[model samples]
Target: MTESIEKIVAELPSLKNVTGAWAVTDERLARGDAVFLADLGIALARTYGSSRQVWQYRSVFDHLLRLLATTPGRDNAVQALRLVGSAEVAGRKLDRYVTSLLASGHEVADLTAVFTGQASEELRACLVHELVLRGVVVEETPGIARWVTSPHWSHHPLGRLPVRLSDVESRADFPNYGAHGSSHSMPYGPLESRAPMVIADARVPSVEETTTQAAAGAMAKAVANWAEESNGRIEARLFVFAEPLDAGSVPEALLTLGLECLRGAGKKTELSVTACAPAQVWRVLFAAASSGGAYNSGSYGAYGRLAAWQSMAALAGCPEGAAVSEVEARVRDGTWHVFDADTEWFEQVAWDIGVAALAPGRRDLAVLAATDTD
Candidate 1:
């Protein structure tokens, strides 16, 4: 509904610190790098796909994005993170502060002092925030600026945001998708453990391209994974958003989305044979087949395994859930795992998971996919 910190962070680049410099010579410069890297990390964290490559915690990136996009300076956001993590303010204060800075060259030294209660860190961080917020600081080594904002689309990831738990679980969290995850789960919290994840580097496709690909890659992969993991014990579900004609034509694109994300990560996955169920009967007949003994009526694959299913979204028989036919989703472990994402659908969950899209969307559909022939 509202713009996000990730939207802005997606514009920044993930910092490797080529100098490998442990520290910067000057404090403000260091703070500038901190803010810049923070933005880049946020975008990287929010990217979607199956990369599973680990890096610095994405929350740090998102927290910094919240700081830069919402707070006026580094120190202020530091306090903001505490307040943010501690349930003080929902971080809107950061947004308001940044809005003022954007309209009128504002600085955060004052608020930084208010937050950290220390004079020096406040000054250093605030200065860094000021420069970056105004588009001055950047990662020119790669010929890139530190931060900017853009949309999450159906693919084509140039990118990239953040949010809370209690607020998220409430109806106020994401009205459209509604509240879907844990308010306070476990070691799985952003604190103790990160979910299996990846960063996206995809670009946007036209409606035709999106549906074709969404059904193929995004939709298919989600299904393939579930079907492979849950095996036939569970029936995968998808929330199709397009009209009938479009759904019928998306098998190829679905394959594209799944294969690209898999191969992009150098996994060398293969597209599983796809089976379609007519929308009317909503009938799907599963065939247990994998050239290398990957699937059968008896067993599922190992964890994080994927399989591609590109045909059910357009099933005209459409179940009761199909009333909201605009999107496709998977029913997993009693939870509706939706991943048919565009810019809008993915905003809350992916960011909450510390992920950004290689592309973007609103409709979240769980794409089940599979690993290939051994």
Candidate 2:
């Protein structure tokens, strides 16, 4: 068996036929041959650059993850994890595997153990970020707390705050901020056909034309990853008014801003709005920023959390080294009034959604609308 595996590894570079390679490996993996799979995983990792295509095979990647989960030997598990990490599966596939490993009781330290050497710290921090975004209960050790709460990580939802296992469990209601379902489908309903009321002194500015560079930068970062992955149009618009809007007019302002941002995407006649708590708003922002708008799937990589925090800080105009409590206080005190809106449009497929924030005192509003058919 060892000789045959070695032969396959040696010939992998010259092999022209993907089917032949799959046939041999898939049959053995189906038979639960852990030894063969483990040996293959190690050899592949040692020569990962050349054997890259072999990892693209789903069966091989799945088998490697299974080995990582069940292998008793720490060395074997580490090797399996390294191989899995080296794979180039598109989108959030790699993240799903990491989530599964964490689910199987593997600690963040256990996974971080594989990434040693000079550049490994960033990799470890990224893994931790992804786990937190996916709603995994991470034990906040001193090292992890520092990594998450560092200035770099503060813009993300849980970054500035202390990470608690209980917080992870309690946040199960995070998705309730917006109307989402188990089917992962967009909530589409009839909208009242009403044109936006043009308030006399209100001004809706293009994202690029925002008066605050920090605000503009934050809005841009918020939708950056989502725009890339969905290959969709995402508009982040800012509305500035001369005076604080009355409670009665907040919804009207949001609807007017939403419609303008959503202009080329077709007509959305009605608007459904729901008020969200500070925590809920932060979670939605973190999820959208971290996971490219597929927050429910746990399919995003490490930088999502980093980008989330940076953007939030920019949006809130947090000073350097601001305390977590201070930032939280600002959010809670209505420096940013958050809400979820469902504009009855883009029913074609997944991830057509809208969210906005109103800074009443600043007389500023930010609206983000995203649509993707693919």
Best by TM-score: 2
Q: What lDDT tens digits, residue by residue, belong to model 1 across residues 127-210?
A: 333333233322331222221221322122111101111111111110011011112111110122223223233332332223
In model 2, the runs with Cα more than 4 Å from the true position are 1-3, 10-38, 45-59, 66-76, 82-119, 130-214, 255-259, 262-268, 293-302, 315-324, 335-348, 360-362
Candidate 2 lowest-lDDT run of ten: 172-181
List model 2 lDDT by residue over 167-274, tens digit each.
312332222111011222223212333353333444433322354554565665745655666555656666666666654455555645435444332234333455
For residue 302, model 2's alpha carbon misses the true position, in angstroms, by 4.6
Lowest summed lDDT window (length 10), candidate 1: 172-181
At residue 354, candidate 1 shows an lDDT of: 11
**Model 1 TM-score, all chains together:** 0.19
